[model samples]
Target: MMEYSDFKFKKMQSQLQEYFDDYFSKEDFLFTLDCDIEDVWNLYLDSFPDEIKGIYHEKPWHDCQRCHLWFKTMANVVMIDDDYKIRTLFDFKTIPEYQDVFRALDEFLKTKRVENLFLHDKHSVGVFRSFAEYDGGFDENHHFYLDLPEKFYEDTENLASELGDALTQRQLFEDTLNLISPDAVDTVLELVHSNSLYRSIQWKDTLEGLKDVFEEFSQLDSNCDLNNWLWKKSANLPRNITHIKNTSMGTLLLDITGGMDLEQAVTNYEKITAPTNYQRPKAIYTAEMLEDAKSKIAELGYMDSLERRFAKLEDISINNVLFANRDVRTTLGEGIFDKLRKNVSRKVYNFDEVSEISLDEFITNVLPHAQEISLHMYPSLKNNFVSLIAPLNEDAPSMFQWDNPYSWTYENNITDSLMKERVKEMGGDVDVDLRFSIQWNDGEWDRNDLDAHSTEPDGNEIFFSRMKSKRTGGWLDVDIIHPEKGKTSVENIQYKHKENMIEGEYLFRVHQYTYRGGDNGFKAEIEFDDTIFSFDYPYKLSNKEYVDVAKVELKDGNFTLTSICDNKVHYLDHAVHWNVALGDFVPVSLICYSPNFWNDNEFGNKHIFFMLKDCINDTNPSGWFNEYLNNELRPHRKVMEAMSSMMRVEDTENQLSGVGFSLGKLGMNKITVKVKTNNIQRIWNVII
Candidate 1:
């Protein structure tokens, strides 16, 4: 049996030698696997023909020949493990089970045809050259094998180091493509090929791709003297880029900047040009301007109804509307102020949405519609609008002029006259150089009792319980424990005479003594050294909670105010707190719609109609009026449609405050209402 196997092995070896001699001719022996020579002999022997014990004249060589041919072509280039499966020389022991190398080979076979592939072994040089010269050895089967050679991996690392060294220029030009212009392209190509980094097999494909991008760019714009432009600009490009991950513009910048981050490089490219210069003109609204606007209204025959709307303006004058000339044109044709209100409500007060309207547009869309404009603007533009308008207006109203100081929240010039006027209105002492006062407003102010407290430089606490501090001679005057239901109430702590004021830090704070109503926040003001500062607590203070409003440092007869409240300093330090309307503060204006005629003579058989008046046209005065409905009233969408239908015609008499069809055979009706634009929840009830 041993002798028979030896004979067969010798025959197999002879056959393989004959095939190699014919294929390679006089070339040196090459293309051997990493396995031992005995393994090759054994592999060939396994495929050798089976001999009949003594009947072996000459067995057919078909199967043996086929196995030998496969070995000479692919098996010589691919390594075989103990199980006889083809694999590359790279060890896969550290990888997870999912990355089985044989499994990868099977997947690669599906898409690619493997010609004479050498896995970059010691014999790869000769094998690679031979295959390049002769291409007719591959079979029709299209089998595949993946060879991850250690030499190629090493080359990748070395190439990265060489590329970094080769790409010496880090500075970038504005126009990256110019660096590789038609005139400079040949020089650039010579530089790339001569650099050992790009000539490597690893960067060969990348170099070709870059050349193609340049060629394509040149073809697109033939008239550009890119060569001359590059010469003048003087730029350097990377020796090789294996991958470009950004925009084409950014990629070229990366090439010029020698591997700067794609996003940062692109941002720099976009900002290469100087920005356009534009200075917005200031918007000024003076008292005379207000009068002129009013005169314009009178000329438009809207003086009577306009005055009625003026009564609802509260702290905002008609000049406020005319000066919001930076009109906002939205998809809904809404005005800018409401958008400002919404933005301020969200603590974002940017005017990017505001756009200027042509004079013709103002005349056509704004001027003639005084009643609609006035009615639409009525109360919502009360406080926060000042924050938006003050910066634009030359004669902007003082922060003191605004009812909601929290809305125009910023440091501003609080003139002495304005302070005196506010002091007189609150009935506080104006003779004193230093005064601290707290005021709060709500529809149910009588129920919410808040007290103001002050700690003087002498450390004496002055509050409602201890109304006077003799050490500092400060009086906690005008304490409103039970405030008037409809009016804003003030509690004052002041040195009655200027001489009584001391030079030291004084702390001002507000204590929520009783909260019988909804969350009602307070506003506090301090005047010292002829300068006044305002602070607002636009947050709910639970019954016993205290807010350290601010601290005043009075040294060398100069006063500096520092707010201790958590609220960040707003854009307009004096603007009313943007979130005030979301709290318990009363709406700037409220209009109640009562049935003009109700057949209440028979209780069960009652029918009532609520009328909507001053309807200049159908669909509720479009523009600002529509904004009021969506933001302020936020009535049921169905109610809006019904009101639009009812108020279709211009009514000279019997103005409509509300609109609803007759209620038949019902004793009562309930309509949902929201008092402020910030509250659109339909949480309030109106009964008729």
Candidate 2:
């Protein structure tokens, strides 16, 4: 009956150290320790110095039963299984925190270590070598693998006292064991000695079997130096010793001594210490880099001095100018990255820098570049200057509207009012609550009949088959068969009285009845409950093909027109065009005209005026003139110039400075235009 405190672990430690020293002194015999999982770690550490550091200290041991140890030194490799299921001592429970320790240990053991202590041994060292019925120990021909049966509480009944102690001690020794340099020596030794099942491995195999297992070890060349391996060989010890050198290069020296190879640590040090060749690009004011130019402009009331004006202009940014011009923004906004030119840097000139240059130098160098508004950047720069002083000068043109450039291009501009006028001039009835009209001609006019159909609010329809709705008094008044060949034809549906109309949606459509002419283009005008809209079908419609024109809502005397087809033009490429031959209506042949010319026009100045030869010089006109192109038809010098250029006529007063191109035979006597109004050719013929 010995008390645990009187067991003298310190005296046993001294005896272990002395035994290791004496054992290593035998030069001919290579020794190996075969112990249980508990005592093996303590025995291994007893042979090494107390300050010795290794990956063994870096990681800790986890569950022995669940995770078996796979160890690899430079010359030896072994996989050891805990014959006793260690977890059963703690009630067969898992400690999750120690799982990380096992994972790390398992990973490190798998890798090849070139500087391990086993590399110094002449032959393989048998660790945890068993000599019982359970076969273990070093076999050069085979790798060690031991599969033992799991022991439950019934099997572990003999060690019930130690098992109970383990359950209570688990929390106290939580995550404390290291697989290589284990610290829990007392607890492990206590458990191992208390269990008699593994006592045969401790005494019989560890003591007697060593002689039988290593019988040829004395005959082999056991020429390892114990003193040199332990103390003399500097590389044998782990690099945990931190010593500072008395030089400027101490940090680099430390890294070299700490096992960091030259490529990894020294290369980076050279890069940091060496001279750099990199030079950053000079900062310039791009359009994005400018400060808020709009706020600066808004703050200025007026500038009386040229210096003040120049200073304000200098402050103005390219962004404000670029935004002001619709053409530049659109051109650059779409695919700006793809369209941007490389190395397009421009030097910014301050007020003083600009003032330094003479008028002659500026005119020769800057003015020519500045006036090139066609370039993307010039317009931005020019606009900024104009915008800076535009508020002060009443006579100056609007900020971005320099040279009267069009904001947008051409579009279909034929409206309901224009169609209504054309209808009246063609002797067709337009005064009604609802009207659906269709007119078409091919110039080589054959007997082609297009029919206009309207479904009244009461569900009664009016067309060629049923010219009159009996229920609603809606009539297809002018159903032209185009019986004669030389004239443009018309078809009209009208509800002449309000009493005949019902308070609901009215649907209007046009059907191409007979395909007799080469051109099947047609125009449709819908007017219902005081609302009106017009559509032009420039494409040839197949026989019996229907065009759903519009839906008209009539409620409480209010009228709303909703187009059925996607008729509102976005781009000119998709817009429908109708060609009308004005044979003897005008003296001039026509070319394409700008629809957006009026956008750049100044207030109180008549910017657009084009005479249609015999056409009246007024807002409302007769004959098929280019109404869509010249939106406001009045009398002006700029308009006359634009008209002469488009018509290819000689403007003797203005010198015809504007540019023009032919619109399919601009020199011909018969001038044709894509008309959107109903029977435009007929109106032209009647007017002349």
lDDT of each: 0.39, 0.34
Give candidate 2 regions above 4 Å deviation: 1-422, 442-446, 528-532, 565-688
> Across residues 170-286, which tens digit of lDDT does each residue of candidate 2 receive?
322221111111111221222223221111112222222222212322343355332222221222111221111221122333344455652343334334432232111111111
What would the TM-score be for candidate 1 when compared with the true structure? 0.24
Candidate 1 lDDT for residue 223: 47
Candidate 1 C-alpha lDDT tens digits along 1-688: 4344434434433443444334332222112333343444344344333443233334322223443444343443432222323333222321232124323433333222212213232222211101112156532211112223243222534654633432222123223453434332332233234321111223345545556656655564454444322322221233343122233433433443465443243335334421221111111122333455555445543333211110111233322333211121221233544544444323222222333443334333333222121122212222112111111222322121122211111112111333333434444565576787777774455467888898888888999889987767888756777665555677778775645678788888888898876475877777765445666666667888787877887776666775465453121253222222222222222121111121111222222222122211112221112122222223222233222223322322322222222245232443332222222121233333
- Give, for candidate 2, the lowest lDDT window spanning 10 residues: 379-388
Report the Cα lDDT for residue 22, model 1. Answer: 43
Candidate 2 has what TM-score? Answer: 0.24
Q: Per-residue error at 473 for model 2, in Å? A: 2.8
